[model samples]
Target: MTRNLILGALLSSLVLLLAAVSFIWTPFDHAAMNIPAKLQTPSAQHWLGTDHFGRDLMSMIMVGARTSIAVALVAVGIGMGAGVPLGLAAAARKGSWLDELIMRGNDLVFAFPSLVIAILITAVLGAGAVNAIIAIGIFNIPVFARITRGAALSLWEREFILAARVAGKGAARISAEHILPNVMNLLIVQGTIQFSLGILAEAGLSYVGLGAQPPTPSWGRMLAD
Candidate 1:
């Protein structure tokens, strides 16, 4: 990886590590409010000072990172698992009714912003992490589906794909063995792109009171406050 990529990765990893550590041990109880120490500047006692609520800012921030990371990871997982298969299937059956249906469905999903969809889902499901994950994950589906379908379609015409068909390989077999392997790099790039988006989505949802419920620090909620 490039130096920039390495640095970004390290920083991201470090934040996640600190967040995990905070779950087990924060210098002060994150939820405990101390009016006496409220709004104090960063000092030996409170490294990042206290918030308006007198809660430890650093502790709250660490927990927020953990919540954001967890939501994003799960949301992306849902997208990749469901979207990749849909894309591959659509590509394998190119020109068929199935392809049209899938792409049309993707377009429909793409029409709405994830945050809007999340708000709707939260309204129904009563606003929580699981509901937020479902909302964001559903949104990611179309994005990955489009990327996978486009990349997989190109691979479908490759030499190996034709050879696989000639060798009596079924559509599923060819897609799994030949097409998937070749398009993985593209998928990886798409995945990286989507992950950042997922984090942002989680933040947005939390800000709107539709994600990561109370007692769980959320970056978006903190910002909204």
Candidate 2:
């Protein structure tokens, strides 16, 4: 299990690094068209075959990496940034009206399928990469919040929490110092899961013409074409 986890993490890291590098430099101009070379099979000149439009498939795939990673990172960041805090607050104030409100909001958001929500947001905000990110990010909020809240509730009853309270440490301080550290491992695991979902979501949005705009090179749009 450990070795497998290490291998998976290394592979994911390598992919992310390659994606980042592709943003700065790819083997060829992804948008450049060569009608004569259209649909050419992979060769020395093109590591991957040319597409129907004669764009280098390798380059386009590399460019697509940039879009996928960017959307996933931004979406996950937005979800964690907003959701974690709300979750912590709710956990600290468990059973209060605010806690009830937050959980109910999460449930309401959860009731909508992520794809449907993405479509609605894209329709309202106009189709674009930004809209896709917002949609995915919003969809992820409930997931992160629920995970954090569940983990935090368990930690809140621990001895350290009692000690902190006995020492007169404030709620926010205890949560930040104690609860966050204990739950960070869980968060990291959840973040990785969300990242995978974000990639799928971005691809779906792009396929439907609601994600990256033209010439941006998204895998979803490429598959759609």
Candidate 3:
């Protein structure tokens, strides 16, 4: 596990460095095309070769890393920001109508896969990075909500939570002060999982022509090309 963790971190950091460097420099313009040079094999001039349009694959991969990172990071942020609160609310409320409502809503969302959600969103929003983000983020919401609520529920029955309640804390205060901290580790683990899923979701959307448009490099679109 430790070895895997280190390897994952190293790979993730490498991708991040590549994306950051791409903002400043790349071997060639990702959007520029030389039809004559198209489909060339790897060489010193084009480390990863060139696409059919002669755009540098290495440059495209670098820029696409940036797009994938941005979409996944923002989508995870949106999921945690919105879903955590809803989950906390549901947990605090327990068996109340609010809890039922929130869980049911999560279930409803879970019924639709991210791809289906992306398709529905793109059908209306006309396919773009923003729409892809929305679709992935929306799917992430239910996942985090369910995880948070489950973890929070377990914590609510703990001695610390009971003590907080005994100190005259209300449901919201007890939840904020006592419950949230206990479940943070679980949330972090789940967030990492969701972040990976966000990347796949973005790629799938792009593959289907519902993600970042042309002139923008995307792994999925590159594969499609």
Q: Give the best candidate by TM-score.
A: 3
- Global local distance difference test of model 3: 0.90
Top-lDDT candidate index: 2
lDDT of 2 by residue, 1-225 (tens): 999989998988887776878868988999999989999998999988898889999888888988998999999999999999989999999999989999999999988898899989998999999999999999888899999999999989999799999999998998899999999999999998999999999999999999999889999999998
Question: What is the C-alpha local distance difference test score of each model?
Answer: 0.86, 0.92, 0.90
Deviation (Å) of 40 in candidate 1: 2.1
Q: What RMSD, rounded to one decimal, does every model reach?
A: 1.7, 1.7, 1.2
Give candidate 2's TM-score: 0.94
Candidate 3, residue 182: the lDDT equals: 82
Q: How big is the RMSD of model 3?
A: 1.2
| Stretches of candidate 2 exceeding 4 Å from the true structure | 1-14
Give the Cα-based TM-score of candidate 3 against the true structure.
0.96
| Model 1 residue pairs with clashes | none
TM-score to true structure, per model: 0.93, 0.94, 0.96
User: Which 10 consecutive positions of candidate 1 have the poorest summed lDDT?
Assistant: 113-122
